[model samples]
Target: MTLIEIMLVLGLIAMLSIGSLQGWREHQQRARLEQQAQMLRIYLSGLQAQSYQYNLSHLLWTIVGKSGCVGSGIKPADCASAGDSLFKPTAPDITVGVYSEKTMGFYGLRNMAQAGHITLTNAAGTIRVILSARGRIRLCSEGKSIAGMAVC
Candidate 1:
């Protein structure tokens, strides 16, 4: 092949590779966010089950920073400090948040008395794992559509 033709082909391949790399990176980030949301949803369901199985009213589920902690009693700080530890994301450049109607603690009951959600954020996007007082769990993109599907 001519040198000029070879160079042109190489340049085209490089451009295509760059675009593919970018798309692959974005897809990876999206998958990570989705996995994080699913993990948080599982944790919430586990907490609800623990509450029901043990029939304890003081077992409070609290999230501090990226950490989720559940402890007996009303103090979130105590929960964070002394409560059973839940999973936290170990990935860099990611943030996890928890929000609840009752910020302090939710009484452990078969039926939740309050609702809350957990959000995971990264450069690619954000996703939410919701916890309802009626003991429901859901996953969705936070305030935005992912690819085309609405946040659940």
Candidate 2:
């Protein structure tokens, strides 16, 4: 091929490579966020099961932008220092927040004591860890849906 034709072909290939790389990076970020959300869901579900198995109440207390803890007790303050440290997102850009009308992250196995949700967000998207009043724990995506997660 002529020199000009060769350069044109190389430029096109470079453009395609850059586009694919950007897409791959976005996909990776989405997967990371989804994985984190699923992990939180499983952890909360385990806590719920433990509460039922032991016939006691469990508490998951969270500090926005910080961390969370899981413990068994009547009050969050009591569980704060004694509770096991819950998982925090290793992704530095992700932010976490807790939301509820009554209280924050109280799980009683028997009845509907409280309902709350924890949200995880980053540049890629947002995922919410929902705790229903009926003691159901689920994960859903906000803004854009992630693979295997419901849209909120």
Candidate 3:
């Protein structure tokens, strides 16, 4: 083939390769988000189960934003705004993970901050939930799943 024709074919191939790489990167990021969201779901279910089993009235009350939580009156509900006493071991910990530039939100609400003791956070492809205000866990993305989740 002519040198010009060979050069043209090589350039087209290079363009295709670049496009494929970009697409793959995006897919990987979405996959990470999905994993995070799933983690969050599992955490929430567990916390709900725990409180329900123990019949912890105060902790359960705090979940849906009612009074009677361990330190709601004495302290603000915002996780970052709380004091040491609010974070005491006796208190049910409802904390989401932290995020900054590495995080993005669904509907621009990536950080759910604190609600009772269920915390939600997202860093772009990563999201987590910290329950009983104890350990940190990941949140699953709201999307269709090949794992037989019929809804997002």
Candidate 4:
């Protein structure tokens, strides 16, 4: 074939490959995030089932920065970013966050939100479990909740 035709064919192939790869990566990320969210949900659900309080309005979950994963309970070193969003952290607050409510059936993607980088929202009104200093996690949110699930 002509050189021009060959070049055109290669270009098209490259473009298609790149696009497919990008889409695949995003899909993987979404699945990973969803898996992490589900894990946190199970944990919080267990807590609710084993809790003594009827409403669980007192239990709170601490958030640990991705940097050091301290102060929050789970050590930063243990947060596996591959399967858990809590394992991911930007910076500044190598270990920053406020306490959250996880009792009474409140759970969500742990540590999926940041200050400057906003977008952490739970619509299902479920729980928003944040990562702990020791790498553990629990449900918590800053806004008013409706006693449901933290729909992210």
Best candidate, TM-score-wise? 2
**Which parts of model 1 are misplaced by more than 4 Å?**
58-84, 104-108, 147-149
The sequence of per-residue lDDT tens digits that candidate 3 reaches over residues 44-122 is: 4554444445543222212122112222233356544554423221122222333232221111122122332233322
Cα lDDT, all candidates: 0.64, 0.71, 0.38, 0.39
Stretches of model 4 off by over 4 angstroms after superposition: 52-58, 67-152
lDDT of 3: 0.38
Candidate whose lDDT is highest: 2
Q: What is the C-alpha RMSD of each candidate to the true structure, in Å?
A: 3.4, 3.3, 12.7, 11.2
Q: lDDT rank, highest first?
A: 2, 1, 4, 3
What is residue 137's positional error in candidate 4, in angstroms?
14
Per-residue lDDT tens digits for candidate 2, residues 18-133, read 99999999998888888888878887777777667776666656656634333334435432455454666767667787676556454444644367788888778889888887
Cα-based lDDT at residue 62, candidate 3: 27
The candidate 3 region of ten consecutive residues with least summed lDDT is 61-70
For each candidate, give its TM-score against the true structure.
0.77, 0.83, 0.42, 0.44
The superposed Cα distance between candidate 1 and the true structure at residue 53, in angstroms, equals 1.2
By lDDT, the better pick of 2 and 4 is: 2
Relative to the true structure, candidate 3 reaches a TM of 0.42
Each candidate: how many clashes?
0, 0, 17, 26
